[model samples]
Target: MRSLLVTGGAGFIGANFVRLWARERPADRITVLDALTYAGNRANLANVKAELVVGDIRDEALVDQLLASREVDTIVHFAAESHVDRSISGPDAFVETNVVGTHALLKAARRAWLGDGARRPHRFHHISTDEVYGTLGPEDPPFTETTPYAPNSPYSASKAASDHLVRAYHHTFGLETTTSNCSNNYGPFQFPEKLIPLFLLNALEGRPLPIYGDGMQVRDWLHVEDHCRGIMAVIDRGRPGETYNIGGGAELPNLVVIDTLCRAIDDAFAADPSLTRRFPDAPAARGLPTASLKTFVADRPGHDRRYAIDCSKARDELGYAPRHDFASGFAQTVAWYLANEPWWRAIRDGSYRAAA
Candidate 1:
């Protein structure tokens, strides 16, 4: 695509996608539209050379204006309210942003870009999560592209609704669209509220590492860079009106993941013992030690037990393969958080703290 519109480009995955696309194809023009919510940060795109538009995706007039004025042929939509815990506490924002906002963007895209007979070249790529498939039993196979959506939480339900809207727009209105449902993403620039980064940051800061329920919930972790590459593959080669499952194929239990993080943190501190004294007053840094900070909390309502994706469709169709194994990806991720404290520190101590 020559000129593209990236919604939620300041958010974690969106920002990574923007950075990747910008680096991979420097000649292409990009315009980022983000609401700058708690999860969205302009610093994520500090080095990007694309145009940055700070606005909500729900603004029909603004979305239309951008699509028309920028001559955007491709729209990579990544905007959504993603946290399940936040959704439980306040679901209205999820409905408004994920469902209604997607509708508005679809309408605007149809009106502004597809109004003419020049149709085949235009595309709308929707980035979604695998939670739409609900929890999977240990004996069950991974979720494939054909899996029926059985969303349990408000967040997943809202994403499922948005997916349906994208499909409807393609079938009824003939809007060229592609949807990709991805597994859990963990990598650089992720907000600290997420499981990996939360535990990592909390462990580093000598705070309690909270684990919901018994911490056996399983998630298939995909590196954010791999996810961005998968999205690029889908946007470039995926057939319109098709849904692809993008997965890292690495599944681990929640508690196992936490323990892995603890070990990583221990090694990190051992490499530089001075870090232990950096936070003198924190309990995790004091008598209790890091591993002892693990605290199991009451699970939230409707928490999914397991989610895994069958991404053979993407691998077979788009020639997409994840290069980083879990160990490598997790190391890179942990290093990023350790190296870039200022980026996540503001969010951790600011408005995003409530979600944490």
Candidate 2:
């Protein structure tokens, strides 16, 4: 059985990955190392069968201890500051977490697995974002695995640096490493700072749904579960020192996504009258359209106009394909948010952090 150490396993994508991995690979031992920051909530991994180590990834000593104690043979590095606007407003945290934290993990992995000319069966999988390829013009082709790095924002730039570090470690130290740069992932446990959950929560609370600029910015929306599956595929079959692009195969503008989310909420309320009582503040409860809440706001700096990924390499090499289509995925996501009010409500009211 493989012993896996998953960094940031309490955060959105990492938690989903942990849950999926635990469920699918029941025999494998899973140990989670998370800092449990504002974005990384312990509640996200409520009932997962894994050892949760609440610690920063930057602490190489701590990482080394975890590796030695857990006998970890695989390290899935997902710990990073991922918010674009937060990176724009304050970039120091992003640099420290994404770049520095990743380096620490690489160093610890090298020390534990490659020190003293000793080699073990191990894999280091790094999760990254497609934004590192920069924006695409309206008529441009999608970003492929071979796309040149042109990160525009601090968050993406830090991720690019981390990706380079992963590559360097693989090439110089002969570490078994693979990287997957995925498109936007949306599903359960996502913080409201992101577009989908933010707009959904705002519409439910009768607040303005702020649309940045004209909201024409396009993105590929990969369901978080699909992303987890893609990651699993890479770990199971991909070659070391290779980079794979994992995409949802659904590219749409931000406006379209918001509109669809609003409609999904409306449909849910119509299908179940009790939803009106559950979310009384929702515009749908008042027999009004959720679209009414949408309002344009000034765009943030370095907002990419479009991001699309071509995962042909992953498809050909690992036989990986996304299972969740946009419509069904959005419906499932809406249902989750509607059902898990308390989970998100705690975050909104500052209680989750207090509980931590």
Top-scoring candidate (TM-score)? 2
- In the range 106-194, model 2's lDDT, one tens digit per residue, is 99999999998999999999999999999999999999999999999999999999999999999999999999999999999999999
How many backbone clashes are present in model 1? Answer: 0
lDDT of 1 by residue, 1-356 (tens): 48999999988999999999999999999999998888888888987988889899999999989998998999999999999999999999999999999999999999876677656368899999999999999989999989999999999999999999999999999999999999999999987778999888877776788889999999999999999999999999999999999999899999998999888877776676666777564344554457788999999899999999999999999999998899999999988887887777778768443432
- With a 3 Å backbone cut-off (N, CA, C), the pairs that clash in candidate 1 are none
Error at 173, model 2, angstroms: 0.9
**Candidate 2 wrong stretches, greater than 4 Å:** none
TM agreement with the true structure for every prediction: 0.95, 0.99
Give me the candidate number with maximum lDDT. 2
Error (Å) of candidate 1 at residue 210 is 1.2
Q: Count the backbone clashes (under 3 Å) in each candidate.
A: 0, 0
Error of 2 at 241 (Å): 0.2
Error of 2 at 194 (Å): 0.7
